[model samples]
Target: MSAEFERDGTAWISASTGTRWVPVIGLEVHAQLATQSKLFCACEVRFGAPPNTLTCPICTGQPGTLPVLNATAVELAVRVALAVGAEVAAESKFDRKNYFYCDIPKNFQISQFDRPYCTGGGIQLPSGRFVRLTRIHIEEDAGKAIHDRGDETLVDLNRAGVALIESVSEADMESPEEAVEYLEALKEIIRYVGAGEADMEKGQLRCDVNVSVRPQGEPWRTKVEIKNLNSFRNAREALEYEIPRQIEAYESGDETRFPRQETRLFDVRAGVTRTMRSKEGASDYRYFAEPDLPPLALSESFVERQRGLLCELPEARRRRYREELGLSEYDARVLTAVREVADWFEAAARLSGRPKETANWIANDVLGGLADPKIEATSIDELPLKPFDLAELIALVAEGTLHSTGAREVMGEMLRTGAAPRALVAERGLEQVEDEGRLEVWCREALEGREQVVADVRAGRIKALGAAVGPVMKASAGKANPRRVREILLRIIGEDE
Candidate 1:
């Protein structure tokens, strides 16, 4: 068998015939719509609301109750479809996917089957590789089944009848890393459109990955589906384990051990995929048009309206930041990582007319402050500090009215109390003292007994001046303008020379 070492040093061997096996990967990502109500009812769409409390007659599938679609959910799904450049259909229909699961009180999920709302768009990786999409279908989520609590399984129907959009990708990914990149990009778009939070931890977004391995020029093999991977790391780990297991199975020439069309669950603890059940095809689920809900017909105007509402996506924003603001790629990526943070930075940048400095301050000071545990506000929106105030702070530093260290202190006070940056600088006595005479005294005192540093500075090793400036700034209580201090030190060394 042919074997090669992965970057992490894991050995991946091909079949016994020395045939190189390439993994084919596809993903179905289900994102919960960020609507206020369930798909077909007015029950509040909430997470962690004491299980089953969010359910109502329509959501619970009472015998006489009929489903009335939530308009907001459809709009949210349309937003995602438009964001991804999917072709939104003029007409689509909901079908009953017949299944008997306790979590699904309806015994059949109302989902779009043949006539999904949108199709034919894909996510582009950072490498410019496009992972083509097959289709995106609208559906309702089933409730959670808690199987870990003893023998008697408990069902939480709070999530029942929640609106979801399942975006199915083609088998366009060959490696786990590409799959993850695609997922992250998709999630970013989803959040950008306000379609969903797409947080994996709260099950707002979940993925099902199908994988198979085949010889380089062979037809596709039987793909096995790994279900309900809550995080990207789990998806990658599962694929890492499964691809090799399937290759080893095929290599052994054991018919029973060959990869089959089946559903599996990721055993996160063991880092393996265990068979959940045989895969069910469309014929098995017995999908049929739901008699209660008629086919959804959308006007061209509605589609255009959603298209008009499309904001600049993260990729385009990153490009703009790089081209217009002269920011490094890393800075552009960090600024656009979140919509709120990007908006905040843009506002600050506009006010200060200093894009690079504003970006740096937001990246280092604002984001770092938000990440602190002591900061009650987790999001930029929650903070009382305004972007304009941050702009003013950046301007102060750029104007040499405040040094970076003093600006940082002012920023901390601004974050804590939403006070003006200038006021904080004044109140805390943090303004830089640029007086030539005063700074010279501190510089002269710092140069004392540091003859080697002075000698180096005199010999044209100007960087040695940094060694003397620290004690000068310390003596000046951090209020001395460091640039002016440097100039004074240079002049003193020149006079002595």
Candidate 2:
């Protein structure tokens, strides 16, 4: 029953053998806590600032400096822990994880070792699969080392003491797709709770993948760690490449070709994983409690206070949108993708009392307008228009005060000038004319020279009604209520019958 492995494009095939291999996957995600100051000092915490400008003595690890914990950082971290349903500890302390990377100013990271602040929570995928968490510990990030400039490696210390929470998940994921789902779920919760902006592009969220492959119904084998995966695509692609690479090595029965327990980096250009360094054990870090910083003691009331700050999470909001608002699945999902946009939409929906129509405006108009090069804002929060204005605009359209086309014009002007919807409608002469007499005149004028179109309408060919509606709209300069024009044309034709 022995066979060799062959490369079948992206998948590895077992030649003449029915061998099934499964990958055990987990992720260690480091999310930067949203805070104004560094973890242990008063230095400002910002991205893309000049290098070495945000460092102080405590963050830089000077001989006589002491690290003071940031209360805001702890508050933000606790909010995330609560959002994920993690159990926060009553007392947790920081330990010095001894490492000697050039980015570490102290040659040791102040981190949680034996006692992390929270434990035992998980994220549920859209498919209802729960990826469990092992622990979430608070730590400080190291500085960046730039090596792309010729042969010289440069160091930037601005990020040295930025607060971070490292959430280590259990090996519960069976596939790369599930791993990405877990990451996206985690990022949503992080942003929803105002804990952090988990933007991977700006280094706010970084991930490390630990994966091992073994034959089905076998015990776990030595796992390889894939680092430097900044994007979810890289994470999935790395796993796709590493899993088969390991399986092929084992099927070859070459002891020397077998995978080792080491860290590797994903080469995005080559679409393969390269060896980084041998994976170190916990003993290699030489963990020790920090003598300067005291143990963090949290009161139950304080924990409860942070819990109150959490709003409806994305999943709950999405469910509510579907159940209460009667929105379609696509609309529910799109509206809840961003917390700010979702909140704006909820406010507009409540104001307009037209949840479905409000969702349409947000999905079809507001979000669509953001793609315009003329709009400087990337998100709803940055736009000049408000929820109240959107609600007014939606109401105008729903009540027949503005035709859909006129409403869109008014919305465009509102976006450009931040003016009231009614003002924009009046100033642009975009209001729909619903005066019965005026509408009948335009409808009759449209049907005057189109006897065949009028006869088709009389014969109940509803599709031909567009011919009459088009002229009425054009004669009124696109300010006629289209529905009313269609009704008037039908009434006039029926009266002549």
lDDT of each: 0.89, 0.89
List clashing residue pairs in candidate 1.
none
Question: Candidate 2 on 73-172: residue-level lDDT in tens?
Answer: 9999999999888999999999999988889989999999998999988887886788889999999999999999888889999999999999999998
Runs in model 1 deviating more than 4 A are 1-4, 7-19
Error of 1 at 403 (Å): 0.9
Candidate 2: clashing pairs of residues: none
Q: Which candidate is the best by TM-score?
A: 1
**Candidate 1 lDDT tens digits, 155-256:** 999999999999999998988888899999999999988899999999999999999988676899999999989999999999988888888788778999
* Candidate 2: Cα lDDT at 466: 96
lDDT of 1: 0.89
Report the poorest 10 consecutive residues by lDDT, candidate 2.
Answer: 1-10
